[model samples]
Target: MDSITFRSDTVLSDVHMYTPNIRHLMVRLNAVGQPVFVSKFRILRNINVCSKDDIGDLGNEENRELVGVNNASTSRVDCSNTMANEKKDEEKKETAATEILLDDDGDLDVPRRPSDFVNSCEKDLWREKVYPTIISKGEEVPFEEYDEDWSICNDIRIEHTMDTTLEDVGKQIWRGAFLLADYILNNTYLFRGSTVLELGAGTGLTSIVMATVAKTIFCTDVGEDLMNMCERNIIVNKHIYGAAGGEIKVRELDWLRDDLCTDTKNPYCWSEEEIAHLYDYTNVLLAADVFYDDDLTDAFFQTMYRILSNLKNRSITYLSVEKRLNFTLRKMDVTCDAYDHFRLCLADLESINDGKTKFIVEAIKLTFPQFLFYERVEQLELWKIIAEPLISNTQQ
Candidate 1:
């Protein structure tokens, strides 16, 4: 039976003595049809029980302007779950937060910082540190820079500096870039006497490292501001890059543009002169830490397909990215949306394959000498991509 019933009588019972009980009684009655009671006994004082965690984070000036992350949403209480499950989960989380934030424990779940927001993806805090290293050329800096991390290779010094409060994530250097750089340093034979292009070359570190080995290195990103910064870095390290028999040029490449993969004569497509300059030097492609978001992952591959397309010679790609395993506040569990999206794109390659055009991706074995002082963590991986079946049909 429903908790509500028609009370035709005007006489009130003891159950109606309490204000809380009367409030619920009125609500239940109104749920059916009690407009008469609604007006006569209008709700005046309402009590809503809330927890300390119910209030969401209202971002500050420095917070909202950050790039690659949206404004955080507010947190609210959910009444759907039974109290038992909620209580148990709360206790488990208290333990999880303390043990998960650092690298030691297998648990990667960072604890909530006692914020009002119910769900926040800002669990992975931004941190900066100067890493010391000696490149294959046997170069090392004894003193670490106070603000920037400086890595020297073949007389070229690349300062890896980052401030988390910025909007352009492409401006920051990631671990994957360093991993790729180390690989290039060890295997200079693959890149020597060849032109190389790096996609999403944040901070241009990988390109700078590769320029020491390759013939000519093209460092490309999306924004003029980012490209300007990349150019400055390349200029600062120009001596070493030139010393290695390569010159550097920065370009703005938006991978999502329809013209990138299409032969259309749209303004967004690379100019004929630009394509002529870049097309001839087809040897290897490099990208690092470019697969962090699902929105850009497919476009990234699309750009790869466009470049690797119509190629008569073989082109190899080395993509190194660190897998993020942070716990999602919205998912309430672990999720790998970026990597999952990548796999999904790979699985549906039939559209791209079409027999005539196809890309074959293979996991580059980790047998290469562990190049980093920290070595490659389980999170970072390198993939060797090859343009298969060749481009037999090309109109000269």
Candidate 2:
């Protein structure tokens, strides 16, 4: 059985656009002719009063990883009664999996209004012959042209991948970013005029959103290509925060490294002044959906400790993570080890009493108002860590 399919002609590009109204960016094909388009995350004006009649339930399967864009298709394999029939079905499974076979009778409904948000439930519905169309780019785009209204003041335009590998997941938008963005937008007083540092700020979406309210934002992540793309996003979305005089400095920060990159020859290296400002002035830290691998989770906490312990003022770190469940052959059941490890790291940090600094962990309730338009999942969580230095007798 062919379980995995690979596309060999994928090419990444940096050609992105931003218009005056901040809508209708041109979708450009990469070197391999794959379409790359802009994903606009609209802000919900009144989520409480929004009509639930049209909005369907977004369960765990629908909101897997709670990422902003879900590209995977779901297919169900039916077992035949006879061995000959089973063999024939197996032969055609590959082709059937790739295409949306809505019904056994081959009947499809009239295409409805386009969906800006893509989820897994729609894919499952297609397999069950209950849905009309998938709203994502490629193969099934409803319109010939890309004209849609995004004149809303709070909509966030992000450059993302129509197709991506597991390694390139950071280049896409995640729902954790939306959760944090909601918290930031709803509780503006917590970050108003504050110097904020966002670790693992992939695509700089959260940082860009934060810049609209915060005084200064340090959007830090590794990889030259990824950082360049993030800087481009910061440039594209500058109009949202530029009028308010909010500044976002895209810098390179590797979680595995103990020291900030200070080499003057490097393009994304940090300056002495910026480093000082980070340790002295930054009062808040933010991270969204960066905890997946065990090794990286360990490195992230270590880096957080180093930054929080040396801060000049009492600082708080807000972390957002979607508890991802997967079936492991070893366990033979669904598990969420990465999220468990993250909770373990939080416990260790809170238990640390080295006499120099203190760490306190708290789980923020998700009762905050929704600002961005996305399928909010229960697995999506927000955690807060408050770090304060302990004053000794000599200091007192």
Best by the TM-score measure: 2
Residue lDDT tens for model 1, 1-396: 222232334222111121111111111111112211100110001101211122112122231121101011111112234433544454344333323222343222222232312232222121111121212231221222212222232233333222222335665456677678768866878888877878999778789878877877767777655565567567766655666678776766778775432234332235566566677765788998888677798898877777777555677889897777769999999888887777676666535655656677778776554222222557778888776644463642
Give the range of the ten consecutive residues with the poorest summed lDDT in model 1. 38-47
Best by lDDT: 2
Please state the error at residue 188 of candidate 1 in Å.
1.3
Give the poorly placed runs of model 2, Cα more than 4 Å off.
Answer: 1-26, 29-35, 45-152, 392-396
Which runs of model 1 end up more than 4 angstroms from their true locations?
1-156, 159-161, 165-167, 260-271, 329-331, 350-352, 370-375
lDDT of each: 0.51, 0.65
lDDT of 2 by residue, 102-141 (tens): 2234332111111311332233222221121224433422
Q: Candidate 1 clashing pairs?
A: 55-116, 67-167, 75-118
Query: What would the TM-score be for candidate 1 when compared with the true structure?
Result: 0.56
lDDT of 2 at 14: 14
